[model samples]
Target: MLDYHIHTTLCGHASGSMEEYIEFALTQPLREIGFSDHLPMIKWAHPEYAMPFEKLLEYVQRVLALRQTYPQLPIKLGIEADYYSPAEEAATRSLLAQHPFDYVYGSVHFVEDWAIDDPHNLDQWERVGVDTVYELYFAQLQKAARSGLFDIVTHTDLPKKFGHRPTKDFSALIETTIRSYKDAGMVVEINTSGLRKPVKEMYPAIEILKLLKKYEIPLVFGSDAHAPDQVGRDFAQARQMAQACGFTEIAVFEQRKIVDTYPL
Candidate 1:
């Protein structure tokens, strides 16, 4: 098993230290583990959602230091960066250029400057209606995949995690967006985090997995873990799900490149 998306205390919302998460993963049968805590925002606008730039550097330094002690473990340093507008993206890239990360998972955690976790938007189904939200969400995802700074696209159908059923049009939009990512040589992550929330299905659902197979696009696995216990969470079932959808191998990244594959 390979878990590519993970978080630690530096992110504010997540708990546990980097050493704790690595120690827990050492007990599992995982081949690789990556710590991809949320990236720092340029304006420090969302302190509750991500770590600040100064702390982020400190966190990276701490993780890099571990390379000496855990030489046998293939620990990767990475980031899960949220996409905003073009200006924000440029600033984010400028900030990221200062450090070295094994991979970057492009994610859209907001829509028009609003976080998905906003209490007012929690009732997205009742507000925007499921169909409209799904359509808009995938459109943003298409924009995110084309951002050109990320190694993998995280949770392609993330809006579906809020208990919304995508309409036919919405699904088609997702297929088109994913195809674009494939053309760009970026992988999609089957994030298992949704399973821990109210949304029982994986991020993209089984149909999306089949579409990935059809498009011959590579797939990767991420626990999207917020704590130590969540590392490699539900990876067994996720691998089975991907295999059933005809995926023989799941991709992994290092130094912002696809470096390995794990067989299902």
Candidate 2:
């Protein structure tokens, strides 16, 4: 199996040490396991995601060092970077340039200057309507794809995590975003974490999956695991979902290269 979006304890909210995650990955016969922990913020403003900026290099070194002991399996050192626009792009690029990541999974955890979980501002999104939320979401996606730094885009339809089910227009914009990523030769991950969340739907739900198939965008599987047991979880069901969407091969990355493709 290919699991390219595993997180470790370096990020405060996640559980399990790197060794524990690697051990679990090995037991599951994962051909490639990517350490895609959240990226440190450019200004240390976001507390909900990432470890301290000072610890980033050390974490990268540790993940790289682990590859020597587990040479039998490919362990990729990567980062799931938060996508910001030109305003903070300089700092973001500087941060990314510091590490030789195997792959960069660009993500947008915040929408319209606020992270979804912000205690005081969430209810305002409901008033904005799911359609407008979707417009902003896909616009950010296009920005992310054109950023020229990310290798893959994680959880393409993450805005739904706030409890707004998407409609036809939303799905269309998402299809356009996915097609842009595919044209740019960037991989799109199908994260299974949504199933465990209140949203109860995978990123880019089944309808979007069909659009991805039409675009011929390569697929990748990620549990978005933050704990030991979460590693490789739901991959079986993820495979079933991929099969139902007509995907026969799921892409895998290692040492910054597209090394293998696993069959569903």
Stretches of candidate 2 off by over 4 Å are: 117-121, 166-168
TM-scores for candidates 1 onward, in order: 0.93, 0.92
Model 2 TM-score? Answer: 0.92
Which 10 consecutive residues of model 2 have the lowest summed lDDT? 113-122
Could you tell me which residue pairs clash in candidate 1? 102-255, 102-256
List, residue by residue over 1-264, the lDDT tens digit for candidate 1.
788888988888888878888888888779888888889876446777888777988878877898777987888888988877666778878877778998888888777556664556676457666677666666777777777878888877777665766655656677788787887788889899889877787887898889888988888889998888888998888988988988899787877888778776
**Which residue pairs come into collision in candidate 2?**
none
**What is the clash count for each candidate, in the order shown?**
2, 0
Model 1 clash tally, residue pairs? 2
lDDT of each: 0.80, 0.80
